[model samples]
Each structure stands twice: as C-alpha cells, then as structure tokens.
Target: MTASPALRPSAFTDAELIGSGRRVAEIEAQALQSLARRVDGSFAAACRLILASHGRVVCTGMGKSGHVARKIAATLASTGTPAFYVHPGEAGHGDLGMITDKDVVLALSYSGESDEVLMLLPVFKRQGNAIVAVTGRAQSTLAREADVHLDVSVEVEACPLDLAPTSSTTASLAMGDALAVALLEARGFTADDFARSHPAGSLGRRLLLHITDVMHAGEDVPQVSEEATVSEALVEMSRKRLGMTAVVDAQGRLSGLFTDGDLRRMLDDTVLDLRNTRIGTLMTRNPKTIDARQLATEAARLMETHKISGLIVVDEERRPVGALNIHDLLRARVV
Candidate 1:
C-alpha cells in the first residue's frame, strides 16, 4: 500500500525571519571586531611584501575563500596594487605557470589545510617566492609554511548549523581589505591615479574631464558685441543653437548674457523693435562664468546652483572663450 504524504511545515513569520538575520549580522560584526585586535606585525609584513613586489600579487584559495580571494585581488588592483586571483584547483592543472619568483602569493584558508593550496607550497619553495597566508588555524601546515601569517580565527560561525563558513570568511575578507588599504597608503595612491584606472566610471568623468573638453569653442560660441542690435543677437543665438548669446564689451570682454527667456520677457512689452534695440540694454549684467581649465563637474554644480542651462568659459582676462549647456555635459557623460 502507498504511504500517506508527510505534512508540510509552517512558514516562518516575518518577525522570526528578521530576528534570525539580525543574529547572523551581529555574530559576523562581532567576529570582525575581534579580528581587529589581532592585527600585529604579521599583517604589516604582508603589506610590506605586497608593496615591495615588482610583479603582480597572485591571490589563491579554495571554495568560499576563493570568492573572497577574487574580491581582494580586484580591490588590490583597483587601488594600485597590481593583483590577480589564481584558483588552486586550476593551478594543479596548468595555472601554476602564472606564479613567478617576482610575484607574491596571498593564500586564504579557514582550516589552513586545503590540499589544493598545500600542494602548491613545494612549487613556491622551489621558486623562492614569498607567501602570505590568511588563515584561522595559526598552527596549520599552511600557516607554518607562510612567510607571513594573518590570523582570522573566529570562535563561532554565524551559521545555525555551525558547519558553514560565515564568521571565518568575513574575518578573512576584512583582513584582505586591511592588507589592500595598507599597501595603497604605502604606495601613495591618489584619487587621480584611481580615476585613470576607472576612466569609464562616473568618478573618472568627474575628476579627469575639463570644461574645455566639453565646451563649444571658436565660432560655435554664441556671442554679440554690446552695441549689436537685438535682431543680430537673436540671429547669432539661432545660428549657434545654444539658446543664449554672450554680450561682450569693446575689448571683447564679457559684459552680460541674453537668453531665450530674456526675449520672451521683452516681447511682452506694448511695442518692441528687435532691429534697433541694443543687446546691452536688456541683457543681464555680470552673468555666470567659469574658467576653461576647471573640472566639468564644477560646471555642472554651477549650472545646478544657478538654475541656468548654459555657461561661458572665460580666460584670465574674463574674455569669452567657449560656451556649453546641460546637453553638452549629458553628451560628455559628465551629467
């Protein structure tokens, strides 16, 4: 005879689920706090080894530790520490060739007895390469063989089953960040250096892009002499398509600005003569201006704060050299 189906268990309440999550976070946070106090000479030695290495930092690990190892490698490389992750499982096949005497190997293991990683120790020894190990077991074979060992031992895992690697992995990741940051500081890595590596990112655009790079220079700039008629200024604005025109003095120095809104306000009058009206009579005096060499991000902020759509780039003598609008910033990917 067929057996009756087993009853399904009730789902956990929201309060119960949230409580479990909080408990896990608290445990992991406490583990990191404990790991902070254990930072000693060995950590410094690891940083020094990576900083002095002429070649890239080769990070390796197995399983969960391998994931954290990849992240550490990325952080190191991004912060000017030249690094790459090598999988121990793959190293035994052919990836071991990636490691060299000039490179430093950073290994991560919770038990410090990962056979895949331990198997590469002999190769590292034969090549005379330095090995920095981040592990929980200080007396494990991997730790004992390392040139520098960073202790990331945790008393308990955040896992309710007590078998998963939760707390230990967090500690290892924290230690990796500590190493990367220390090496970054030692190498004197700057924001400009970072921007160069991440030129496709928003931070790179903000830091490396100049106003002149995104502005319309030469004849593209809409402008009219202070004595030019309103009709002439409108024609220049229409031809340039910037929706605005700069009013300059006899010396070609910027004196005022006339925008499309200005024309609309002037048209509200009982009668207006665009051909006979001088631009300087109705232009806003002492308009906003920015230096050509300034950062494009600064231009964005200026436009935002002033609620204007365009700006005039000026030289040392306050002469109009270029003009730009919000659309230019958008096109340059600086917005």
Candidate 2:
C-alpha cells in the first residue's frame, strides 16, 4: 500500500496569522475612510429629512443587515431621535401599518436586491414616506427606488472565502453610528437629555437625583451642641451610625464636625477629659457642606476631594438639614 502523506508542521508560524489579521484591518480601515469621503451634501440632506419629520425613523432590513438596523434604531431613539426597527419579512405580515406618511424609512441590504425589501418600496412610495437606502450597490433595485441612497460599499469581504458579510456589515454599522452622532450634535442633545432617556441608568442617578433625595433628613440627622462634651458627641455619633456628628451653635447653624478619625487622633495624643472638654475644642471647624439641592454626584466629589467619608447637608440659612455618607451614595447608585 502507498504510504499516506505524513502530517508535518510547516515553517510558516504565528507571524502569518498576525499578518493576515493586519491586512484585514488595513482593508476595513480603507473602506471606512472611503465612506467618510462619501459624506457630502447628501449626508446633511439625510439628517435634515429625518430631523424635519414629525414621525419616527422606521428601520428595516434582512439577515445581518437587519441586526445592524435594529441597533441603529435603538441608538437613534436613545439619542433624542425617535426610531424603531421593523423586519421586512414581518412588514409583509401586518407590520407595514407601522409606517405612515410622516415617518421616514431607513432600509438596509448589502446586495440592495432583497426581494422582501423591494416589494415594500412601492407601498412606502405610495404612502408618501421618504425612503433612505444603505447598500453596496447604488444601481440595485432598492437603491434605485429609494429617495436617498447611502453608498456603504466595501473593497472586499473580510472572509477568506469572499462569500460572507464581514467588512460590509462593519462598514454599515459604522455608517449608522456616524449618522446617529451627527444628528445628536445637530439636535444639541445634552447630557441632561440623555439622562432623561435613561432614567434607570447610573448617569441618571448622578445627574437627576438631588442631594436631598438620598440624605438622611429630620430625626436621622445627628446633631450636638458646640458646648456639648466630647462624650455626648460620641454618643450622638453612635446613635446616628454615620461615623460623625455635627456640632451646632445656639442658632442651630453648623459650627463644626466630630468624626471617628478625630477620636482616633485624640486617642493617639493623650486621654482627654471627656467630661470637661467641649466637642468644639476637638471638632473640625467650618466643615465642608453641600446644599440639599445640589446633585448627588457633586456631593460625592466633594467628599472625595476633601478625603472625608461624610457631609452635612445644609439649607440656605446654613443650618444642618440632613446628612449623607459614602454608603448612602453607594446605596443610591450615585457613586
């Protein structure tokens, strides 16, 4: 019997794999760069069309392009632009009603020849809806029927077999991101606006929630007179469980603060006459404070900047109204 060809490792090594990866990177980079150059008057016109529309941006596609369309719709919606995705196959089965005259349609197809997508073009046109097409073939049926065509053609597929949608999908996704960002800039979408869109997110807690929302109010605020003994202040701190107690004057304004760190320092120096020593003698004078109306994130920063764990929340009259610590911020998800 003829000897089977011996299996042997070639001299070709890791460098070849890395080199192939670099080549693919270079090609995709070039494709994106070409896409950037294609952003001309048409890009601005597309933004204007969507911005002026009263209805939502209805995004639709097939296969991988459909996945990209869904993501783009989500991004646009979250960035102050109303948008939603409609699968082309589903559109034929009753989803077509989602599109109205006021809506603008964004259709994605790599070959620009998806039958389901083409079938809906006449309906969209008859409804008086504006259609924007993202495709590799500008001359394809979908593109030819569209009111505006965005060319997202790539030089070649990243797949070695040249059969899969790889670089094309990346380019399309990047283009969609570019559109979202451009519209965001044009609409002057601020961080506050983004916070409103994501009220349950961390950014919302940091931006929208005030210090009063998380601070301990009423009986929870630990307070002691300036003339009170150190022992009395310590008892108040223990009762409040905030690691500190505010020392107030006869006028009920904050005068100083006594913290656990202060107690430790006092212990290291010498035993104080707790009964005779006033809390004001050992407290930190003019302690850093925050307004109740201030953002919780600002309160957190103040604590970090001063290297302190807690702060006394005060009103316009400089009276202690509440108390907050790092733990409160953590619990509130503002940190």
Candidate 3:
C-alpha cells in the first residue's frame, strides 16, 4: 500500500516565533560575552607575534573554519597588518613555499584535529615561522604546538542539531576582529596611511585630491585687467564660460573679481555705460581664494560655507595660478 501524504508541522503564532528568536539572540549574546571575558595574556601574545613578524601573516584552516580564515586575513591586511589566506590542503602540496621565516602562521580548527591543517605544522616549524592556533580545545595537538593558543571554545553550538558550526564560528570571527583592531590601534595607523593603501576608495579621494589636479590652467582661466571695460570682462567671462573673470593689476597680482552676480547688481542700478565702466569699479576686490595645493574637498567645503560657486586658485604671491568651479569638484568626485 502507498503511504499517505506527510502532514506539515503546525504553524507557530507570531508571538511564539518572536519569543523563540529572542531566546536564541539572548543565548548567542551571552556566549559572545563569555568569550570576551576569556581573552587574556594569550590574546596579547598572539598580537605581539603578528606585530613582530616582518612578512605577511599566512592564515589557514579547513571547511567552515577556512571561510573565517579568509575573512580574518582580509581584515588584517586592510587594518595595517599585511596578511594573506593560504589553504592548508594546498600548502601540503606546494603552497607551503608562501610561508617564510619572516612570516607568522595562524591556523584555525574547531575540532583542533583537522588532518589537512595538522599536516602543515611540520613544514611551518621547519620554515622557522611562528604559529598562532585558534581552536576550541586547548589540549589539542594544533593548540599545543602553537607559539600562542587562542581559545575560541563555545558552551554550545547555535545549530539545533549540534553538528554544524554556529556560535563557534561567530566567536572566532569576533575574536579575529578584536585582534585586527588591537593591532591597528597599537601601530598608530593614521587616516592618511589608510588612504595611501586605498587610493581608489572615497576616503582617499577626499583626502588626496588636490585643487591643482582638477583646476583649469593658463588661457582657460578667465582673466581681465583692472582697466578693462565691464563689457570686455563680460565677454571674457562668456568666452571662458567660468561665470566670473579675475581682475589683475599690471604686476599680475589679483586686484579683484567680476562675477555674474556683480553684473546683475550693476544692471539693476541702471549702469548703462558698460563700455566706460571699469571692471575694478564693479568687482569684488580681494575675494576669498585658495592655494592650488589645498585638498579639493576642503575647497568644496569652503565654497559651500561661503555660498559661492567658483574660486580663484592662487600662488604664494596672490597671483592667479588656476581656477575651479563647482562642476570641477563634481567631476573629481570631491563633492
């Protein structure tokens, strides 16, 4: 006889499901809290070993632990500690050559007895590299052989089956994060250093992009003499399409600036003799300016705060060197 259709489990009420999730969250939080309390001299020792290493930290593990190792290596590398992930299985074949006397090895195993990981100890030792073991069992061979042993033991797995790694992996990842932050703080790593490492990132663009890099130079910069007529200055502004023109003296030093706003005020006041009116008479003299070497973001902030759309880039002697507008900043991604 054929079996009847299997009955689905009874649906849980929303309240009951919420309570179950809350309990799991509380239990996992407590587990992490307990793990934090266990950190002591061993954690410090591991940091010291990694900090002293002249070469990159080579991280290794198997299966689930292997995923955690890759993340830990990336975190370390991004936070001033040079590190790379090397699969233990691959290391046993030929990748062991990546480990050098100047490097430190971090091996992870939840059971503390992964055969593939264990096979790498002899090669690491022979290469004269220091080992830091992250495992749940302090008495395990991997932990016992390590120069510094970090205990990542958890009271229980979050998995209901008690087979898949859950709380244990969380503890290991948190511990790895802690190690990376501690090393970063101890090294006094600065934002500029981080920007150098991540030049293509947003922070790098904000901190490293200079005004000279994006400003228009030479003839592209709108300029007129102090004696030039208002009509001539207006023509120059239109030709350059910069919305303003720098007014300079015979010595080439900036005397003033005539902008679209100034022209509007002049026309509103019924100044009809544009050909007879000198640009210096209608210009804003000695306007706020910036050095060519200043960061583009700083210039953007200055413009934003002053409610201006453009700025004249100047040299040490206040001579017009370059010019930039809001469009330049937007194109450079400094806005």
Enumerate clash totals for all models, in the order shown: 0, 0, 0
- Alpha carbon lDDT at 153, candidate 1: 99
TM-score of each: 0.88, 0.87, 0.78
Q: Model 3: runs farther than 4 Å from truth?
A: 1-40, 137-139, 153-167, 199-204, 225-227, 249-251, 255-257, 261-273, 281-288
Over 57-131, each residue of candidate 3 has an lDDT whose tens digit, in order, gives 899999999999999999888889999999988987788777889999989998899999999899889889999
lDDT of each: 0.93, 0.91, 0.90
- The TM-score that candidate 2 achieves is 0.87
Q: Write the per-residue lDDT of candidate 2 for residues 1-335, one digit (tens) a residue.
A: 76555645556679998998998888788889988898877778788899999999999999999999999999999998999999999999999988889999999998999998999998998899999999999899998888888999998988888888988998999988988999999999998899899888877787799998999999999999989999999889999999999999999999988899999998999989988899988999999999998889999999899899999999988899999999999999888
Runs with alpha carbons beyond 4 Å of true place in candidate 1: 1-10, 201-204, 262-277
Candidate 1 lDDT by residue in tens digits, 203-264: 88988999989999999999999999999999999999999999999999999999998899
Among residues 3 or more apart in sequence or in different chains, the pairs in candidate 2 whose N, CA or C atoms overlap within 3 Å are none
